[model samples]
Target: MKLLPCVYLSAKQDPTSKQNLSAAMKAGAQCHGLWVANYGNQQTNLRPWNRDQIEPANPVPCKVLIHQYAGDIANGLFDFNQINPFLENPELVIKRLILPPA
Candidate 1:
């Protein structure tokens, strides 16, 4: 079972900025998935630009997989997450997370 190489984009580091992504690529990171840790709100919705905003600067395209949307849900113990629902091929995405590319 192979897992995708993922990058964690924290809110403190401005997770939504392209500069962060560029930096990750410059650092020799094979980022296939992004784990965005932004405790903005307790909503299970995909970001507005997550669907069609692909940075041409990246070698391998990376997409948001698990989003840490809310924190301290139960006495500051748990964090809420949501899979990006706006992706083109969600099944393929899931497979990519757990399986190596063909």
Candidate 2:
């Protein structure tokens, strides 16, 4: 099975809800590496690597891992149309899943 990172975009102010996540499971989404992060920059004493390393791992095996790369897009998290551009590569206006390189 192929494993790819998934960007869970929640329309609500908070993270993706349990209801939504449950629905996703019924639809065959197996959530891995699940965690929550509020949008925006914050101060922390821990170095980036150390902090990231401590983030919990997914106990359940899944084809997708939830990722957060909602980089400072203007209409991001609000406009659905903006999502396509945010995910496309140059020289092509396309819709595709962007998985991290192996």
Question: Judged by lDDT, which candidate is best?
Answer: 1
Clashes of 2: 0
In model 2, where do residues sit more than 4 Å from their true spots? 1-3, 6-16, 39-41, 47-102
TM-score of each: 0.48, 0.30
Cα displacement (angstroms), candidate 1, residue 80, comes to 1.5
> Per-residue CA lDDT of candidate 1, range 2-99, in tens?
22545656645533455756665677756667766765555444445443332222333466766665544445545665567776666765565675
On residues 56-95, what C-alpha lDDT tens digit does candidate 2 reach at each position? Answer: 2322222222223334344344211222212234222222
Superposed model 1: Cα runs more than 4 Å off? 1-3, 14-28, 41-61, 71-77, 92-102
**For each candidate, how many residue pairs have backbone atoms clashing (under 3 Å)?**
0, 0
Per-model root-mean-square deviation over C-alphas:
6.9, 10.6
Span of ten consecutive residues with least summed lDDT in model 2: 78-87
For model 1, what is the alpha-carbon lDDT of residue 29? 56
